[model samples]
Target: MTARADHLVGVLGGMGPAATADFYARLIQHTPASRDQEHLRVVIWADPTVPDRVSAVLEGTDGPYPAMLAGARRLCELGVTVAAMPCNTAHVFLPRLVADTGLPFVDMIEETVGALTRAGTAPRAVGLLGTRGIVHSRLYQDRLRAAGIRPVEPGPEVQAEVDAAIRAVKRGELATAGDHAVAAVRRLAGGTVDAVVLACTELPVALRDSDRAGLPLLVDPTEQLAVAVVTTCLGAEAHRAG
Candidate 1:
């Protein structure tokens, strides 16, 4: 499956550097490529210095929009036709970013919800595990409701665990982060939800196979976004080839 020469995928990342790297790895893993040449061209603009998206969304702090828009412009200058932001919280600014750059973006939130609705036995109620910004902004909640799926959120205490897990991942504490994230998942699973969405990019990094065992079905939005990006860059037929 040869990659399309006219297509280049852009990654607007670095909201947290590890999540960006994880997303790129997933992009490679999902690409239907047995050889290097079959892989799509990708340009990543990762700037960790961008202001905090959670603060912008939750606390009325300075926005990360300027920095994000700058990254999109850079991808555009580099001839990238499509873009994706791995950080779930960063997507709060997605609409404006697309409008300003005229660069189409793969919406992680939409892809995540679409995956659930398309599942063999679509989940009637799904638990959401994301940052406070994504939760507060109703990013996943709104989409899940529109898709006719009930959205379940963790209580404040459980959300604190999620927040701690995200922070732990940023600080390079995978084991500790996994503990916190798994604890949160266990709490959410105790509720009536059938599956859980690891809505935050970092949550996927924090959760391990052992952690997921015996837990409710977990959806990784980063993986969903990666598959979508591969399809977008390679076309549906080529994407299915590998």
Candidate 2:
């Protein structure tokens, strides 16, 4: 089923709880709110059991497709008008899930790419810092290249570090201010490209503390997607009324 024009946007999240929360916060932050109603009404299903997206991609282990479907279906049953996932790598199975499911999952990478182009990013080299699956997968590459941006990747060692940091967040080791993933950020800093993308939700683990200055970084695809959700699903009437 589709949204009824008044129901809240549903999120199929919590692949890593931290990233899910981040996306939720962004939804609130991006809204032009004066009161509680001004804020978008969001119903979220942050299920961690959806399996490790990075692990399935890199180690060829199990993924959370079935679990993810269950979570999204739950949101639909709850009368969600729209649904999306904050996790990037989990998008790998989006086609399959979306094909059979009634709920439509938003495109995280496409949203980020749209935000970049709207920000007038140079159509040259753009760096990516995501899980091993996203790094190696053509998910970002296919969309980014179509947008005329050559997506750059971290070296093997840096890729390993990023993967480690993502795992660390899942284990609840990193601070909100960002501590454990500094080295990885430094390795893929401004010098690497005009801008960098924290393609994985686990990244911002070392927010300000990481070597994340100088170049612009697309820290949250969820944020960009949320903004679109607010504008589209909710519309200006909601914002104005809020």
Candidate 3:
């Protein structure tokens, strides 16, 4: 069997530094193992200066992709088998990122889809809550449909709350301080459907243990994605034996 240290989980995070840290914390706590060696190898490049993914995409990156690429390359250099970004918006550039970095990346979209499917939660209409770029670009919508699930875009007014909460986090607000975000999500989830996917990493921690909207709520994709990463990075025999 390969030594656990021989593998590393590359995190292209720091879209919100705190959320990135939160994802790591959750992974460490949730990893199923008796020995520390059973824990997955991990590396992270928390580049807070990666620019606003929403603006960069909707408006324009208007600059070099060097910084983003450099971050991923650094992880690959560290010898990580799989790298994943916690930021949903940054996913906009992932195809090129994967091409340029030559690093196997766990897709947040695909991971989310698979998680929903495993729970047998497919085909249930889900409320969309994410950056304007994600919503306007219909990023989640396209992928959700591919998974045979229906997605509902939050009305413009509710989206305002989502935007405010995201912006507040960017401004370095306490992850759980955004009361309005919870209120916004609760409003959107009411009488909606089966569940709400936090979609944004910033949101999972930001939303925390707040009251649910009488509808089931899905927490951080980052946390779940981390679980997926650890599972995938574990050698085949280890996984089978696990």
Candidate 4:
């Protein structure tokens, strides 16, 4: 497939720098490109200065909309055809971002739920592991319910562990992060959940395959978002060709 010069992917990231970097890597890894010329154009605005999303959602303090909007606007100015955010917690403000910027963005949360529904014999219940903000906002829960799948969330203790994993990743402590993430997954697996969604992008980076042994199936939202981005960009090219 030939790359389209007209299409550019904008990543509004740096909710935590590591997760954003991971998402970009996944995007490149998943793209159907044989040579450098076959790759899609991408612009990334990674500003770690964005206020804390967790504090905003959990405590009602620190609004990140302005910083996020600024990033989105910058991407728009760069001529991005479509945008995506890697952070799950930041999605709480996605509606306002899209409305304010009038820029099309691939919804990571929606894409994740859609992926689950499309899977043959969708799991009756799925575990959610992410920042306290996303879990409290019920972003995944509401969408999963809409898709006729139950969303199982970690308890306070497990959620704390999940938070620790995120922090570890941000600190560049992969080993510690993996330990925390695996512990949370193991705890969630004891429940009736058929699969666990790594709702936080950092969780996927932290949790390795060796750590996943005997744990329930894990879903990575970053992976879903990458696939959605590739499809959105390449699909648009195909549509234009037709």
Tell me, by lDDT, which candidate is best: 4
Tell how far residue 90 is off in model 4, in angstroms.
0.4
For each candidate in turn, the TM-score is 0.95, 0.86, 0.88, 0.94
Q: Could you tell me which residue pairs clash in candidate 1?
A: none
Residue-wise C-alpha lDDT for candidate 3, range 125-166, written one tens digit per residue: 878778887776677888888787788888888788888787
CA RMSD per model (angstroms) = 2.0, 3.3, 2.9, 3.4
**After aligning candidate 3 to the native by TM-score, how far in Å is the CA of 231 from where it should be?**
0.6
Could you tally the backbone clashes for each prediction? Answer: 0, 6, 0, 0
Residue 131's lDDT within candidate 2 is 79
**What is the Å distance of residue 96 in model 1 from its true position?**
0.6
Ranked by TM-score, top first: 1, 4, 3, 2
| Cα misplacement distance, residue 133 of candidate 1 (Å) | 0.5
Give the least accurate 10-residue stretch of model 4, judged by summed lDDT.
233-242
TM-score for predicted model 1 compared with the true structure: 0.95
lDDT tens digits, residues 76-119, model 2?
A: 78877667888888888777777767786678888888777777
- Ten residues in a row with the worst lDDT in model 1? 233-242
Clashing pairs in 2: 3-81, 38-242, 178-205, 178-206, 178-207, 179-206
lDDT of all predictions: 0.88, 0.72, 0.75, 0.89
